[model samples]
Target: MNLIELSPEGNFESWEISRLKELRAEEFSKELGQSMLYENDEFRLWDITLKHKERLTFRRVVNDFSYTCITDGFGVIHLGNGKIQFGQFKKGDICSFNMKENEELILDVENTGLGILKFIVTELKLK
Candidate 1:
């Protein structure tokens, strides 16, 4: 896989994939310890809590678009090609990425009690 470092110090090394594997759709929340905190026609929100050193394999389904906010602790997202740091995300301090359908990703949690909120778009309309 390709790796890119956007930071001058190159802190991206910690986010690299070591032994991650793609999770099947059936695994879903069961593997991530997640629960649907809220949902609506426009989007769905999920809340997840992870223990120290825990990880969740993520795969984007077709037409999926989502945002994640880390409420507690620190984490990382591995996009197979590269990675990004994930910590407390304030309003207006967001980052995003685009990917093809069924792309597999990895979420690594550091520090116990890692809390995350995921907002997923569900209103895709084709012209």
Candidate 2:
């Protein structure tokens, strides 16, 4: 998976950590995406779109989920704890993660590419 993982034990520079802490102080979304396109008893669907130089912070409660890239683009993944990463993805690329109980993932995403970066996230709610 192209997903980025962030932990205090991970290799992250001092400055990057500081910046992540700063971002954590700002507002962040509890939802997985910029917009909740749909939701029901079984799952929730979301849409996220980012123009060049756009950034968004999100607190993701870990669950089994998958997402599809809607456009080819590059971007920075910033964890709540301040780890920064640059990633490139194709238009059709898709990624998914399965979380056991008590696991959580949270981060900020910034679209650094010129092209619009978009994704559709499907989260399967636990029983």
Candidate 3:
């Protein structure tokens, strides 16, 4: 997987961004075990928690231009019909997506030990 550290200037380096793209491409049908984070215009932060190092599977459907991130944990996110993107998420990580349609954001926790925080976007923005 391609790894990139957030830049001090808040802009990702060219090489690092390219590497992130590669990682996103290779994330077909793979289960991820780590903390997840995302943000949009209305909210500044959203944290998805994983318990006992559990796994979350991300699947992309090329024909539909959509993807799904399924966690046996807890979280909420806007779904859409566009090129799905993902990367290795850690504490303080953030990403944004454009919502083309009204989508359902579902949160499920398989174990009581897991917890998460979700945010919704009222305005369209990416940073």
> Would you estimate the TM-scores of all the predictions?
0.44, 0.80, 0.23
**Which segments of candidate 3 are over 4 A away from where they belong?**
1-47, 55-86, 102-127
Most accurate candidate by TM-score = 2
Cα misplacement distance, residue 46 of candidate 3 (Å): 5.8
Sort all candidates by TM-score, best to worst. 2, 1, 3
| lDDT computed for candidate 1 | 0.41
Candidate 1 has which clashing residue pairs, if any?
Answer: none
Candidate 2's residue-wise lDDT over 14-66, tens digit each?
Answer: 54555556655665566888899999998999998999998766666577888
**Stretches of model 1 off by over 4 angstroms after superposition:** 1-33, 61-72, 82-127
| C-alpha lDDT values of all predictions | 0.41, 0.76, 0.30
Pairs of residues at least 3 apart in sequence or in different chains that clash in candidate 3 = none
Cα deviation in Å at residue 22, candidate 3? Answer: 28
Candidate number that wins on TM-score, 2 or 3: 2
What is the Cα-based lDDT of residue 67 in candidate 3?
A: 23
Candidate 3 all-Cα RMSD: 13.2
